[model samples]
Target: MAQSEHLTIPVGTVGSVDSVGAVDSVAARMRALDAALPARDGVAVFNRVYLAVTEEVGRRLDAGGFADPCAAAALDVRFAERYLAAVAAAAGEGRPPACWRPLFQLRRHPGIRPLQFALAGINAHIGHDLALAVVDTCRTLGCPPAELEDEFDRVGDLLVSLEERIREELMPGPDVLQIADPLTHLLGSWSLERARDATWTAARALWALRSCDDVAEEFTDRLDAAVGFAGRMLLIPLPD
Candidate 1:
């Protein structure tokens, strides 16, 4: 595990008017994280992928691509904080969420491919963090999940596109990949589209269960474990 490195930006409420600054602050922190880690570190690999996505999202926000800039910024920042918090926790004595533990634990292993690290991080973030981020955004914006649907869908679209690009850029080319390769099968098994769909459902369910604290907590814990299990599968070491 890496030593604790404090992230300077404080996570706080972002009102509608401060959306741009909030997004910029989040992007800045991710840039700092990217600079701090060794390039081959699994966490660093994932961070680079995420940093690209964050930069693109920031560009979209500046270009007015989202219908609700305030809602989009809130969702984007809250979504990012979950991943950052996990990194921070793992850096210190505290443990990250179950969903994120596998990647952090195996980040430096020789056998795991960069693509595996990238997807595993995506699995942890999308499968687990996204739902909670939705709830967090709702609480901050004082609106129901339904109201945030457009922003959610838009952000998800960006991730789905990025997933495709990640596979292309990191995975062995089609000419090089063999049918018997475990990486091929593993890649075939998980789909970001499926994960995003499931996340939306989970977010809605969580919102519905918000009034029931114990039940919601149990649901979240179960979700965390399930996603972590999937992440572990995604990070399975493959032969060179």
Candidate 2:
């Protein structure tokens, strides 16, 4: 029952594209990511989960799911641009935002579980990038965060739904998740629901600080550092 305009390829399949900057370029980015990163790589694990979410959103958009498809697309593209920017920076100058430094640094460390990589990336993206992306979307669409509330909520809901799947798909297995395992303790400490709520609050706060350039920059910096700290903790190397 998919719409006629929807892409025929399954979600998470990367394909050739000119660039990752366009709203239609998510699948392309995903495709590049899949081709570039090894299957067991930490970043790839998160990228696959993220790619699925992005493709699903695209399908919903094609089906006219959002009240404002334009707003939804803007939000989606801006959000993705932040993540891609981090990747590019990490690959080149080795200076991504504080929130993203951990994942990039530990991406290939065998000691870090796939679940940890996935959640740490989620923390960086949601805790830091999401607020900025909201502002970016608002600026691009020439509106305020209040105007994009519905789109924001819808996208957040999608993320929330995927969080469960990520855990289930990446989990080390029931025997490995015993209470004695540090992974269990690590997994229990972070909650996507809490992170989503915090991001919404931060977005609203940033929107309010739009006129105060210095204060807003400082606020953003602190948020980045704090999220990065959490990511560092999440990426703690566990024993094999």
Candidate 3:
């Protein structure tokens, strides 16, 4: 995708706010992006999926689902900012993280299925961004990863459920999807449950290495590149 193709959304608009207001702002920004992108655009597909998740997270916050509402809100907003920043970067000369590059680059490829685009985006966000978001949340909230464990798990559980729905709604049906299908193999190689577990570990590791700036930066860079590689694999175009 060209730089001009990525319509700029002012990422800073979703600034720090109280618990309820923070989530509301994130949902609002996502909804705005949903309205701006082409319906069939790959990024739009993922944006719609994320917006649904964000709205659901907001609903849960309203219903008092999280044990630590404030921590939850902080984590949620920080998590969302990483994605919004990537979008903003793609819109300008700034480069998005390696983890997010594939989706931005392949957003308009016709041969890639919507499922592929969705999972690729999920892979990058969950596999790389979520871990850093956890660290970011910890710093902002002045707590350890363990303190934020409940919120992380709750948000992750929501994502896992959403992944199921995405597959159900987007995957080729049994009659059409054959044993030899490349999509099956591609999708099978990645698992959200595993990614979530790994992200938790990475978050903890990042927290531990925080004092070692150089080491932490190297680790983060490696994580970004690895997730980007996985995203590229997930986005491999298959026969329609």
Better of 2 and 3 by TM-score: 3
- Local distance difference test values of all predictions, in order: 0.89, 0.81, 0.89
What total of clashing residue pairs does each candidate reach? 0, 1, 0
Per-prediction CA RMSD (Å): 1.8, 7.6, 1.7
Tell me, by TM-score, which candidate is best.
3
Worst 10 residues of 1 by lDDT: 1-10
The count of residue-pair clashes in candidate 1 stands at 0
lDDT of 1 by residue, 1-120 (tens): 343245433445546324567777777888888888888889889999898888888999999999888889889999998898898787766789999999999998999999999999
Sort by lDDT, top down from the best = 1, 3, 2
The TM-score-based order of candidates, best leading, equals: 3, 1, 2
Query: On residues 79-133, what C-alpha lDDT tens digit does candidate 2 reach at each position?
Result: 8878877776665544789999898878879899889999999999999999998
Between candidates 1 and 3, the one scoring higher on TM-score is 3
